[model samples]
Every structure is written in structure tokens, then in C-alpha cells.
Target chain A: MEQILRYRVQNDFSALSRFLEELRGLPGYARLNERQAYRLGLVLEEMISNIIKYGYDDSKVHEIEVVIRWGDMKITVELSDDGHPFDPMRHHCPGSNSAEPLEQRPIGGLGIHLARQMSEEMTYRRENGRNILQIQIGGGVAGD
Target chain B: MEIGFEMKDKMTIVHLQGRLDAETSPAAESQLLPRLSASGGNWLVDLKDLEFISSAGLRVFLMLAKRARECGTKLTLCSLRPGVRNVFEISGFCTIFAIEDSPAGI
Candidate 1:
């Protein structure tokens, strides 16, 4: 058996913690402690913020959808937004990772990079003109 | 997130408690920057009570730090929880900003 929790909220950042906090009461959540919860929260927040700030730049109406399902060994999270389409997985940092001057190096692209560092697997797709992001959390993965 | 500010001697410390995720980031940016700008002293961010912070929160900090540098003031971060510290370290912000493990040493 699996558990799923779904939520929809405005395209804002203040509602993110409250949205993610509702998942703490699930059965499998007992296996994932506060540190794991914090990682999930961080990644989800980064994705949501990017969607609202850059995807929906015109401040139009939009909805954010989050779904989490847990099994015996893995936790799956799906975050979808009905705003403009943004595939953060495709973004690449423009710097050479050199010790060059700060002004000459690029400043952006840290969000997706951090997500890649935290999650076991991350996937992005655009279906029906909506940005959909999927991430999986496994029990075997060590905490960063 | 609830934000409280305190001024001690020549430095202003901003205590950020709770989650500094995407939604609460803008409110923090709007509230914290103006105060930091108006004050004539350096800023030390106390994140001891902060349970979580995302890249959006990091973005706000970077922007505020950049603004502070441009205005000839210093911005420092102290007392980061383990979760928040990992985000900061993973994002390479520890190199970009001044960070300390404890407020007592700063």
C-alpha cells in the first residue's frame, strides 16, 4: 500500500513550509527524520520559487501542486505548476569553476545544482504545457 | 517565519527563526534590507533558531550581501543549523560569504 498527500496553493514562498509540513504525519515519514525533511523542503522550495519568480514573471494567477507517496523503501515526490514552463534540469552553470575574479564569473544556476546534490533521482518534463518535476528519495541514500 | 532585529553596540543582529523558504523569503528581504541599509553598522545574521533554508533564502542573502558590500558595510552569518549549513555549503555560499559556526566567537 502507498500514501499520497496533495496540496495546491498560490505561487508564493511563504506557503511552502506549511505545505511541506503536512507530510510529517505520514506512515513512512517516521523513517525520514527532520534532516531529510529539511532537504526535501529546501529542494521543493527552490523549484517553487524559481517557477514563481522566473516562470510567471508577469505576476499572473497560477497554482502549485505537490504530491508525495511513500513505499517501504522509497519516497516519491511530484511537484507540478500551472505557470509558465521552466525546466531547471536543463540549466547549466556558465563558469569555469576557476579562481578568477568574482565580477567576471557568473552568479546564477545554484538552485538546480543543489537539488542535484541532494536527491537520489530528479526528473523534469513538460506535459500539457505544465512544468512537472519528480524526485525520489530512497532509504539507502545517506544524508548530506 | 518570524523575524526579529536587535542592535548591539556597533553591529545589528537579525535573528531569523523558522523556515526561510521561498514564500517567506521575499518578506524577509523586504524587511531586513531596509533596516540594514539605514543602520550605520555591520550586520550579523543569527540563524541558530532557523530550522530550514532553501536556495531562495540563499538568493536573498546573496543579494543583501551584495547590496551591503556596495554600500561599504559588512554582512556575516553565524550559528547555522545543520540543515541550513549543508545548503549553504552545497551552494558554495560558504566561500562567498563570511560564516561562523557560533555567535559567541563572532
Candidate 2:
């Protein structure tokens, strides 16, 4: 059987924290190995934090929808935000010039890069004025 | 996240416990940034008990490293869990910061 978890969070850090807490209480979360779970959490945090910090233009409150499907040795997370249209897949990844000095290195792109690196697959698209990002990670279920 | 520190001779060891994400990163930065001395010194961050970290946390560490460089202070990170290690490696932080298995040698 598959376990699907859905969550709605505001465009704020505290909401993200609460959503993560709720996620950890689910049975599907217990099936994940330490590494898989960590990657999932990291990806969610990176994506949500990015949307909260940069996805919005006005001071109005917005809601982000998160859906997670777990089973079949895989876990997929989908995040939908009604903020501006931004594609994480097209975002730049920094640290390409590893030899560059620290002062010259830019810090803006590392979050998206790390999120992309942690997941097996990531896709982004704009639909109905909403930005939808889907991330999938394989081999999520742990063995006894 | 709980931040604690211990001074040992010329080296100061800082212990980080709990999650370091967007929610806690601002407080972590406020506490950690002020601890970096303008004078030269050695510092080690122990992450054995740190359960989680995201890009927000990584940004704080990067800022700390930059400040340490400007102050002529030595900064090191030690005892990272496997998950945290993966994050550092992916972000190329493993090359930028001095990381070790433990605080025994350095």
C-alpha cells in the first residue's frame, strides 16, 4: 500500500517547521533510512526556504502545498506555490570555480544546487499561475 | 539548536546540537558571529549532535569561515554525521573548511 501525505504551509519559517514535525510522525517516515530521510528533509527545507525568501514580491501571506508519496522503495515530494513563477531546475548552481577565493564566491545559488544534488530527480514547471516543483528519491525504504 | 562552547588553551571548541535550518539559522548566526574574534585564534565546531542542517545553516558557516579568514583565525569542523557530511561534500564545503573525524589531533 502507498502512503500519501499532504500538507499546507504558509510562506513562513515556522510553518515549515510545523510541517516537518507533522511529517516525521507518519508511518512512511519510519520506513526511510537515515540518509534518505535526511535528504528528504534537506530538500524540503531548501525548497520551502527559497520560496519564502525569494518567491514572493508583496507583503501578503501565501500558502504552499506539499504532497509526499511514499512506497515502492521510492519517495516523491511535490511542492506548489502561488507566488511568482520561478523554476528551480533552471536556477544556476554555484561553486563551479572551486579555486575561486571565498570572498569572491557567491552564496545565492547553493540552496537550489544542494536540493538538486540530494534528490534523484527534480522537475519544475509553471501551471495556472503556480510554480510546481517535483522531486523524487529512490531507494528510500530501509531494510531490516 | 543549542550552542555551547569550551575553551581549551588556544583552541575554542563550539558544540552545536539540534536542527540548524531556516527557523534556527538566524539565532545561530547571531550567537556564532559574535564569537569570532578579530584577533587570531583557533576554533573548532563539533557537530556530532547536530541532527540536521540546510542551506541556511551552510550560509552561516560560510560567513563564519570568511570572517575567520579576515581575522586570521583558524577554523575547523569535526564529527559530522554521514548525512551532514554529504551536504558539506555536495556544497564543496569539505574543501573550504578543515574537517576531521574528531577533535583529538587538532
lDDT of 2 by residue, B2-65 (tens): 9998988877889999988888999999999878863356899999999898888988998899
Model 1 lDDT tens row, A43-86: 67667767767777666677888887766556688989877777
TM-score, per-candidate, Cα-based: 0.78, 0.93
Candidate 1 lDDT for residue B78: 95
- How would you encode candidate 1's per-residue C-alpha lDDT over B3-98 as one tens digit per residue? 988989999898999877666778888998788779889989899999877766776787777778877888889998888888887776777778
Q: Which CAPRI quality tier does the interface of model 2 achieve?
A: medium
Off by over 4 Å in 1: A8-18, A21-31, A52-65, A80-86, A93-109, A125-132, A139-144
Task: Tell me candidate 1's interface RMSD.
Answer: 3.1
Model 1 chain B weakest 10-residue run by lDDT: B54-63
Clashing residue pairs in candidate 1, if any? Answer: A13-B22, A13-B23, A14-B23, A14-B24
Candidate 2: residue A47 lDDT (0-100):
92
